[model samples]
Target: MHGPASSGWLLVALCAMTGTYCLTRMRGGGATEQRRAAGGEALMGFGMAAMAVPAAVFTPPSWAWSVYAALFTAAALPALWAARAGAHHLHHLVGAAAMVYMSVVMAGSPARAHGGGGSGVPLLTGALLLYFAGYVLLTGVRLVPVAAVAGRNGGGGSAGWGDRPELTRACRLSMGIAMVAMLLTL
Candidate 1:
């Protein structure tokens, strides 16, 4: 198994895929389908949260951290707003909170690292990764039930061609990416 600190990029890749899938579904132009696509936003939130774990663990340059911080914040605001519109899917709320928590963790990392006596980078990163793994695992598992619900309702109907496999595959991809990234850190 891959170590925890390296998993950030996997999270980024997963977020990217999840975001892409969501955007594609949103473009389908069916209100119901579009509403369903909002789930992607939650995935993105989880992915981004996963990403922060590595970034914090790896301690990339200050600039990269800043960029990630800004992008994550921008991405999460809409997710929170979207959650407000669809309160039934608690995933939205959890995902949004995860993303926001990631942002805080990312912002606080530098200070934490600096405060450490010396050479605590690895420990810091490991903690971040652990948090991310937990977040991803929980969020990722949470999505399965939602997707199943969608599949049972109408997601597996005619729209199945466009939605089911793509969403399901995207979830797997996200987990895989996070796993790979974490391994790389070792």
Candidate 2:
């Protein structure tokens, strides 16, 4: 199996691919395309979380882990703010809050100073798992309506999954995954 560092890089690559796919789908501009694009963005967030997981889990050097935690935490803000536009659901809010909590714990973890698992690790991992589970569930459900609309006749209306609902959910899922991974690693 690939090492943690390599796995992190691979996840980064996955994020890039998904992000690109999102861009393409956005340009295409349709219900199916938009929903798929949103899914792609969510996939990117998952990739980000995947990249951070090993660093958090293995207890990398304080600075490296700190940077990883910081980046993930910072990314969540725009996501949370954007959710305000009504694109996201309650699950997104919960997931984002969990990530924020995880980030704070990770930022202050004593494990980094000692370079091994310590008192707070279990809480961190548990929190992350919960967050990830919620995220996945929310994303999976959010897609249902969009998929349903896509199957409808007459190309659907101008307002549909191709609009805010799908995009918001996609972003919610993506950010949620990253946050969950970060928490788990902590």
Candidate 3:
């Protein structure tokens, strides 16, 4: 069996994938989808990477931390506005909060040889993990049938993203898993 030490790489890879997904979502026109894909997602990717790969953000200039904090906090605001529309907005809000928490952890901690140490708040981490895990399980169940349908149709269906059930569910599941991976590194 693989050891726990090796698992960090998987989390790192997931972070990269989440970043890529965010960028791709920028190109997609779905209102809800695009809303979740806000610019803060790239920062979310960076925040997660910093957690998994110690060197990634261990020693940036002081101002970078401030920017990250501001950006992530700002990102969460819209999610509040979007929350009335659906649970996905709530996910975004949580994701943004995670990013902000991460930024604070990174900014305050001094760089060290092994990853930099910070005051990791367990309560927050646990909450994030729980939420994301549920999201992944739900997403996985949704994807099973979508694969069969897509195969039969030769690809994604012709319906608009809002009209396509699979697309939104897939995105939710993807980000949820990504968030879980990120939280694990903390």
Candidate 4:
């Protein structure tokens, strides 16, 4: 990340925490799809944390960038398969692709080489920014208390911490915001 070390650390903390929470969610009893979704989110959170690490703290070897790109590209395949069952999986696919895109852009950038501003195609960056901004807004709206009241009133009673929809939405929203922040650095 091309920014103050403090901000980069903050992003790292947020993403790592989110990833840890998602790992717990995966272990909790839930539908297969839900567990699968949580698993994917966990992967994304950890990957983002790694990518968000301040270049000044640890500049990865040149080969590491290609590895990152390859990893996300491979991750996208499962997301693509899952997308056939649910629209949420489509979001996962996009997120994986975005990570791959960032890895590739960062690999060739002189700014990253010097621990300065990141370089990327302006148009693609703008498009990704717009998509993530919209996702953050939509996820934020979904997290409003009014939306939770109905679920609370349902006969299911209190959901387990890991299975709580609100928290899942909040987690997604946080990642969306993080994505926007990451893109801005680019």
Candidate 5:
């Protein structure tokens, strides 16, 4: 209940729904890449929920910072390793790192000290926001109508989940926006 409760719930619902979609995607029997994508979706789903609480309540447990920071940090490593595979992997790496950064920031405060102000905003926070904003926009544009985002891993046509590129891009875009919302609340 820090910002508008409705907005908070909206984010929560969005994240949860997307996460469930990811879960379904996870079960999606395709290539290794499809499974990886599904895993990221699940993370975003739960991650959004984690962020949603603080967005609404304006307060998160002190321990949550360490937990999220560590979780995202751990998530980042695999993403980095996968980066050699393609540009999408690079994006995933960056996204994971962004989550880590946000977690660390929230952990340090844990009481909404950074709320709606510029006095104490970290320099890195700005950079992170810039990256995510660009990511959201880029993902959005790439998903225009019939145009598919590249490096889907599921290959083209009849690939089931991977066959539909928009869903994949939407997941990334949604998480990026969610991350921005979480950062602003911090």
Candidate 6:
């Protein structure tokens, strides 16, 4: 979060709120896959919020980066397994892997940890940026009223808050935007 304090705080708020909503989704009586997805989203949202905290406010210890990398690595395993059931889970896998990648990059570069924009591999960052940028666009298009209506009707009717596909897509879209912002900082 190498931007202004206001922008960093905004990122923190957006991510924390998304994480909270995902937690509630986990408690709702959605399908198994939906609940599972929510659980992973919750983890990702909260982790992003923590990482996005401005360095001026709190710089994590050197070892903490390793811990973040490890945690996300663990998260990715289930996402990889879940992808066997649905393609959407692959997005979760990529997100988790991206978190791990960022954590490692930050850990090795103290300058980046302090928001000085250290030497992360530009090529890798560009690749991730491209992926998440496409994701944000795709998710945004899916949020149109026509697409929402189709998704709802296809689901058989109104669903509980947690099972609402539109909300889930919106959540993912927000995360995708946040990811793009974060990568730009890198």
> Which stretches of model 3 miss by more than 4 angstroms?
1-12, 29-52, 56-58, 110-118, 148-171
Which tens-of-lDDT digit does each residue in 1-186 have in candidate 2? Answer: 013566555555555554554554454456663454355455445535443544444544556545655555555555566566654433444444554454455457645423243425575567557757866787768766874335343564443334445655565555555445444444
Among the numbered candidates, top lDDT falls to: 6
Where does candidate 3 clash, by residue pair? none
Residue pairs in collision within model 1: 2-183, 6-181, 6-182, 7-181, 7-182, 10-177, 57-125
lDDT at residue 156 of model 6 (Cα atoms): 41
Better of 2 and 5 by lDDT: 5
Ranking by TM-score: 6, 4, 5, 3, 2, 1
Better of 1 and 6 by lDDT: 6
Q: Write the per-residue lDDT of candidate 6 for residues 20-120, one digit (tens) a residue.
A: 88987898777787788899999999999999998878888899989999999999999999889887899999999999999999889956545677547
Report per-prediction Cα RMSD to one decimal. Answer: 7.5, 7.1, 4.9, 3.2, 4.5, 3.5
Where's the lowest-lDDT run of ten residues in candidate 3?
Answer: 110-119
For each candidate in the order shown, give its overall lDDT on alpha carbons: 0.49, 0.51, 0.62, 0.84, 0.70, 0.85
Residue 66, candidate 4: C-alpha displacement in angstroms: 0.8
Q: How many backbone clashes can be found in candidate 4?
A: 0
- Winner on TM-score (1 vs 6): 6
For model 1, the superposed segments whose C-alpha errors exceed 4 Å read: 1-13, 32-59, 63-85, 88-90, 111-161, 165-186
List model 4 lDDT by residue over 58-153, tens digit each: 888878879999999999999999899888999999999999988888888736533466478889989999999999999898889634434433
* Deviation in Å, model 6, residue 118 alpha carbon: 3.8
Pairs of residues at least 3 apart in sequence or in different chains that clash in candidate 4? none
Two-way TM-score contest, 2 vs 6, winner:
6
Name the better of 1 and 3 by lDDT.
3
Q: Model 1, 1-186: lDDT tens per residue?
A: 112344444556556666665655554545773545455554563545445454345555655545655655665566566666774234444444444443444455544433232222456446545655665676566666664336543545544534554465445446434543432333
55-169: candidate 3 lDDT, tens digit per residue? 4433457677678778888888987787888876787788888777766765666353125333467787788788779879987987878742344334544333333456545
- Clashes per candidate (backbone, < 3 Å): 7, 0, 0, 0, 3, 0
Return the TM-score for each candidate structure: 0.46, 0.46, 0.67, 0.90, 0.81, 0.90
- What candidate 5 gets wrong by more than 4 Å, as runs, is 54-59, 113-121, 147-162
